[model samples]
Target: MNNDEIKAALTSKSRSAKLERRGKIISFLCIALIVIAVFAIFAFVAVRGIATFVGTKVTLWNFLSKTAWAPGTTDASGVPKLGALPMITGSFGVTLLSALLATPFAIGAAVYMTEISPKWGEKILQPVIDLLVGIPSVVYGFIGLSVVVPFIRNTFGGTGFGILAGTFVLFVMILPTVTSMTISALKAVPRRYREASLALGATRWQTIYKVVLRSATPGILTGIVFGMARAFGEALAVQMVIGNAALMPKNLISPASTLTSVLTSGIGNTVMGSLENNALWTLALLLLLMSLAFNLLVRWIGNKGAMK
Candidate 1:
């Protein structure tokens, strides 16, 4: 090669290498910043949450087990009644009920899309599901307030705002997410698996239930866990429909409250650094930990799926 061409080639290589190094540095910085932010948040929440116990005299046992939640009032022992059992029960009740209600529908719709009618599922249902997911949470809450609350009040005979209403709202809110994930999972199944099942004299129903659904169990469970996490974390919508009553649920239609709802409603009213405010922070910390647990569960499920 001539000297001029060789010089140009060397310069080009040097510039490319410099650009690559800069890109790597930028990517690393972005990742490092994300990790640092996450840990900072965790630490901040932990400190604030622990302050409820450390800064005050509230014992962990009283906070967790007692049912009275009158955070502003003190009991005979001079400790504020800050029991979270009712909210905890309400949160779990709504999450589990909504998930149970949504799962069968989601699985059926997913199966229909993937196995029964691909064209319609793709062209029509997919967009509808996408639209449902795009709708704001407040809108869902409003609709629940206007429609579901009235229906429950008429049918079941109460204020209509309670765990049942919250469950119905969350069912609709989470259905699209679970259905879409199930569709993806089913689609991820190898076509050869289906053919193999069919060749073994399995009927379509058998192949689907015994093969496809079985193979997609991990992904389906992951989707359900994600839905449950969303349901558990939901605040504004749930607060609007859950009656904001900090009492243990007596029945599906009875007035109740969840942790997220109480936090949303009460956090604004309490002064910062007070027992009430710190208690709310403790709930926030619980939510953060639960979110982490959900993520860990998803990772575990993914690993198990991979091993299979």
Candidate 2:
């Protein structure tokens, strides 16, 4: 090659190498920042959570076993009781029930959107669902209070501010997340899979039910996990309807408090350095742990699905 051509080629190579190095540095910096942020949050929460026990001398077993969570009240000995079993069960019950109620509707809506009505889904339904996601939690709470609470009270004959009210509110709140994610997952399934199934004499319904859904199972599960996480972490909307009673959930209609509700209601009222305050920190720590566990479970399920 001529000298000019050689110089041109060398300059281009130099520029490309610099660009590549810059991209790698940017990517590494982004990843490092994320790792540091996660570790920092965990450490901060952990120290505070442990301080509740270390500073107050309250046994972890007592925190777990006691059913009453009367942080404001004390017994004859003047020591506050900080049992969390009731709140723990309440959180689990509402989260699980909401997930159960939301999952089927989410999956069915996703299927219809992706497979049955793609045109209308793209033009109308998707935008509406997206709008639902942007609506504030407090708005949901207000709606539940005005509409769902009265309906439940009139129909079921309880106070209506209970687990059932919370469940209904959460069901609506989580629907958009689960439905949108599931639709994306279903859409990700290759068109050729459906074509092949139909070519093999499988009916349309059979192909969607067996071939498409099976292939999208992992993604659908990931969406469900996400929805459940949102449900678990929700505080304001649920707190508005659930009566915020720190008691074990007796039935669907019973007034109960989840961990988030208890934290939101009690944290502002407790004095710092008190056992009550520290116990609330412990509850925060438990919530963080639950979120981490759900994340790990999602990763595992995703990996397993990818392997299959």
Best by lDDT: 1
lDDT of 1: 0.94
lDDT of 2 by residue, 174-203 (tens): 999999889989989999999999999999
Per-residue lDDT, model 1, residue 221, is 95
* Backbone clashes under 3 angstroms, per model: 0, 0
RMSD of 1: 2.3
The segments of candidate 1 whose C-alpha lies over 4 angstroms from its true place after superposition are 1-13
Least lDDT summed over 10 consecutive residues: which range in candidate 2? 71-80
On the 0 to 100 scale, the lDDT of residue 197 in model 2 is: 100
lDDT for every model?
A: 0.94, 0.89
How far residue 227's Cα lies from its native spot in candidate 2, in Å, is 0.2
